[model samples]
Target: MDQEKVNEFLGRFVADLAATEAAGSVVIGQRLGLYRALAEGPATPEEFAERTGCHRRYLTEWLRGQAAGGYVAYEPKTGRFSLTEEQAYCLADPNGPNLPAAFLIALGMLRAEPRITEAFRTGEGFGWHEHHEDVFVGCDAFFRPGYAAELIPHWIPALDGVDEKLTAGGRVADLGCGLGSSSLLLAEAYPRVTVAGSDYHADSIALARKKAAEAGLSDRVSFEVATAQTFTGTGYDLVTMFDCLHDMGDPLAAARRVREALAPDGTWLLVEPNASDTVEENFNPVGRLYYSGSTFLCVPNALSQPGGYALGAQAGEAAMRELIAEAGFSRFRRAAETPFNVVYEVRL
Candidate 1:
């Protein structure tokens, strides 16, 4: 290799090492509530410590790290730290849609590092049945209500003719339904449509049943313990999977199951974490972030090859279409696209 090129490579490697250590700063700041406190204006380190109930020395160290990582700004003369308007939007305001609750879910996965290690060694996920129970213990109250009250109302209508189609009773099933958020929303929206929420986790089914009852949709919506691989219930007009297909070990098998369960002309909807449009797109910063996050959380389940879980190659639209077709779907089209996800409607 050229000497100058070699030197540049080493320089980049050293910078990557530094970045890895700083990666946890965002999580730490969020857990400490420091970002929320500094949202309005700058504050002296001592004031920040008082506001967050932390020792001044510890606050100073944290602020220095955050500033160095570009998550916060610091003024040496004023001895103060502050969040920019962007930071305030993304991290501080609880009501703001920019808030990073996804990171909280990511951090929760980190707590399962030991399980991840075991899965890696055995080439199997910790098992979604057990994992879901641990993951959603306290998550339902926030996820179900938040998505229904905020995201669904705004976004679901964007699907072409979806609102009109949902007006009358239409059969809907939420595959890999966590706490029945999507199913409950559909149940609440269309009193006539029967919605079924299914997951491999027994605890999740129990919780989903409880929430559906509380939402007064017990009659219209039901919960069941089922895995995507073996899921079988036919004659459904629509089937939906939200933020879950990537986590399955056998997504194609699950997709096939969904196809078998659908009405002859049924629609199969999938919402998954965004991937790049091409291999070159993965070079971009945002794409890199998405890919890294999936590696740590989403794609590993596929790699593990457990029952019901199938390993999926990281891919974009073309790759997704191929998988859907392999699963026996006749046609596929993009129903919606967002910065964070891609929604597809496949026809049976």
Candidate 2:
């Protein structure tokens, strides 16, 4: 081995260990509202402890860790720490755009590591429902801001003539709706449209119901415990699947179900991870992020079910278009995309 390359690899290993611990700290701060509290102002460890009523020693160590990680600025002279405006926006404010909620997703994955490891050794699979509770919660939280920022304002409008149909009280079925974030957003945005959100996870459906009630959209948006391939009700003017199709056990069957459920002139909007059919083309930060989840969650979930076609998270546009075509949908086109998602429009 080249000594220089060996040294570089060793340095990366050390950095990775620190990064892993840093992510754990981030999750703790996020869950305990430490970041939120500190965003109020610079505080000595004692002051932070007093304000938050947390243990003094714990806050002290956490503060030092955060400062060392450059997440919080340390005032060595005063032994205080503070968050910059950008840090506050990204770490403290959950409602803000740059919020970092992936730590929660990481926590869920870490919690599932044992099962994932077992599955890996046994050549078996694990269900999405088998993940830590935070997996769905974190996923919903992580994607909520983007959906809120884009879905109705941009994505919905981007679909050809679907906006008018929705405004005219056309029905929508959001398959694999998770916690119903998109469904609730749609009902809120288009007063005339009736939205039905469905998920295979009973727990997620229960949470979705609670969320709809809290959003005061229970009247217009209803959630049901149903899978994409077996969801009831038809004549939907629009059907949506967000960041979920690839993880499906039988995405082809799901596509066919979406087809049968659609009205003759209906639209199907698929929002999947931004990647390419070619693995070499997907070698980037976003692709790396998706592949990590695919290995631990998406692939396992798909394999757990009957269908062996685990398309995985990096299923890209080409694969998706081909799958939709195979499902008998004639018109499929790339309707819209962001750096993070690829949105396709399907029409019968």
The lDDT leader among the candidates is 2
lDDT of each: 0.72, 0.90
Which candidate has the highest TM-score of all? Answer: 2
Q: Give each model's clash number.
A: 6, 0
Q: lDDT by residue for model 1 over 1-348, one digit each (tens)? A: 699999999998887766666546665766677788888689888888778898898788878887886878888898888998887876777654433454455555566778777766776555444443324643453344445653356546655555566676788888888878778878777778898789887888888899888888898898888888776578888888877787777777788888889888677777765677568866776677666656556666566555454433246777688889888888788877766567787886
Full-model lDDT, candidate 2: 0.90
Off by over 4 Å in 1: 1-7, 97-160, 184-194, 203-221, 230-234, 276-281, 303-313
For model 1, the local distance difference test gives: 0.72
Which digits, one per residue and each the tens of the lDDT, describe model 2 over residues 218-284? 9899988989999999999999999999998899999999999999999999999989888998898
Model 1 lowest lDDT segment of ten: 133-142
Displacement of the residue 201 alpha carbon in candidate 1, Å: 3.1
- Superposed on all Cα atoms, the candidates' RMSDs to the truth, in angstroms, are 4.2, 1.3
